[model samples]
Target: MTSNGTSIPVTADGIPRPGGAGSLAGRTVSRIGYGAMQLERLRTDRAAAVALVRRAVELGVDHFDTAQFYGDGFVNEVLREALAATRDAVVVTKVGATPDPGGPLPLRLAQRPEELRASVEDNLRSLGTDRLAVVNLRRADTGPGLRAEGDQVVGLDDQLAVLTALRDQGSIGAIGLSSVTADGLRRALPAGIVCVQNSYSLVSRDDEDLLRLCTDEGIAWVPYFPLGGAFPGMPKVSDEPAVHAAAREIGGTPAQVGLAWLLHHAPNVLLIPGTADAGHLADNLAAGGLAPDGEGLAALDAVPSRSADDVRLG
Candidate 1:
């Protein structure tokens, strides 16, 4: 599926193959991919961190979502050691933020076009790769995280210009956007986005319109907080009564049911659920294979969707 009629083969690890096939920037990748932000917690034991990353590869993880600013580049450092001898997977990283270890927040906005290019270089250098597979420009206009202020409020086209130039020069494979609004995405469509990373889940679904836009444009909708990002006033998918019911009827965990609902909801949706724990990673990988019965699916579909302001722990 490399833009030709010939079929591209995915690696088989004896995991369930249903709902496994999907596209990321014209490259076929597992619909279920691993996110690398959680690796920062494992920095104290680099070997253990690298081992976990390798274990994921063994489990058939092909797409790795990461950021150079994550752990002040510790995550990519581990990836560098773990993936040094291998280049089989597509490594997707993001920009528009820098680590602020001393600040109240872990990251601060760097949304200017120049900062975007510098962050890409940081990723390239940290990852020990001359070129990246894909680079998502993490915007701050809207957030499950920080918002851009004053000087950080650069236009989307300005940010994309540098990314497009890098892609043209072969420094990156494809370009994507994260935390973008529908209007922002529409502006970026001409830049040929391959995927989008937004905060979406079974409960918090304010971005359904944006998700639908991605579906129509053939852009991979990679939900960041897929099980809910655990922000205040936000509900995790596991807390939903319908999700638990689906789990009971489908013989799956609430988490597995929630994730399965996403896969079944749309063919364009891809998942990047992250974890520092090995067992949790296995559970996430297996979520792609869960098969919900009609009743289970119906109960899940009937669950009420809420926006960030409307939901609270009640």
Candidate 2:
């Protein structure tokens, strides 16, 4: 399937494997990438997380999504240890949110110019890298206590000013945005956004307009929750009857079917499904090789879209 008139690439066997390579700020990465958020919560040992990262690298997954806030900086350390020998991997981490010193569940936005610098420095120290591959300026409006009284949120230009200065100083190679709306993108585009990470899935499609905008602008749309797994009030993809039915027909797990739909849904849609177990990681990665039939695709598409309020970033 083509997205916004762009052809979806497939392998010779008609399966999709990473959907051809795409570039983010001149750094090439696989379309199907690994997200490291799961490492923060996995009951498995830290060694298992490290092994999973290495296994992902062996599976041709060069794009890794991580954040300094994840695992209170432990996830980045795992990436540092796993990818130390593999220098070509493109590790994308986010700033603008930190675990509230008061507690673990609530995340506080840290977008102050100096705070942004500190966050980048923390990521640098944790990831064991002199310069970050990509740093996303995550929006604060989506979180707690950062909203402006009326419409006067922190200026995107101000944030970009700090990021650009760091880029000039070789602390960051590229800058992107996270959880931003269409208007936010318009305001930040002049600052040169190479990608946009947002909440998008079959059930949570409120960001469809933003996805279209990203597609039109040639920016990579990296959906964080591709499987619609666990959000505060939203339903998981596995809970949907259509998803299960389609999975049964397609001879794969519900998660695989959901990911396959994403692979076929758009040419610019990059996936970052995270997992801790090696077997589950292998299964998730193999979703790239599953192509749903037209009937199955329609069934997957028929799943109802959840409201925007159901989305709460952890």
Best lDDT among the predictions, by candidate number: 1
Write down the TM-score of every candidate: 0.92, 0.87
- All candidates' lDDT scores? 0.82, 0.78
Error of 2 at 72 (Å): 1.7
How much does candidate 1 score in TM-score? Answer: 0.92
lDDT of 1 by residue, 1-314 (tens): 00112232455444433247888988777888889999998888998899999988878787889999999989999988887765457889999999988765788889888898899999999999899999999986554667667899898888899999999999999999998889999989999999998888888788889999999999999988788746777777888888877777656688887788898788999888889999998988877767656766777778887765333221
Candidate 1 overall Cα lDDT vs. reference? 0.82
How far residue 116's Cα lies from its native spot in candidate 2, in Å, is: 0.7
- Candidate 1: residue pairs that collide: none
lDDT over C-alpha atoms for residue 13 of model 2: 33
Q: Candidate 2 clashing pairs?
A: none
Cα lDDT tens digits, model 2, 181-256, are 7888988887778899876788778778888888888888898777665545665678888888877775778898
Tally clashes: model 1.
Answer: 0
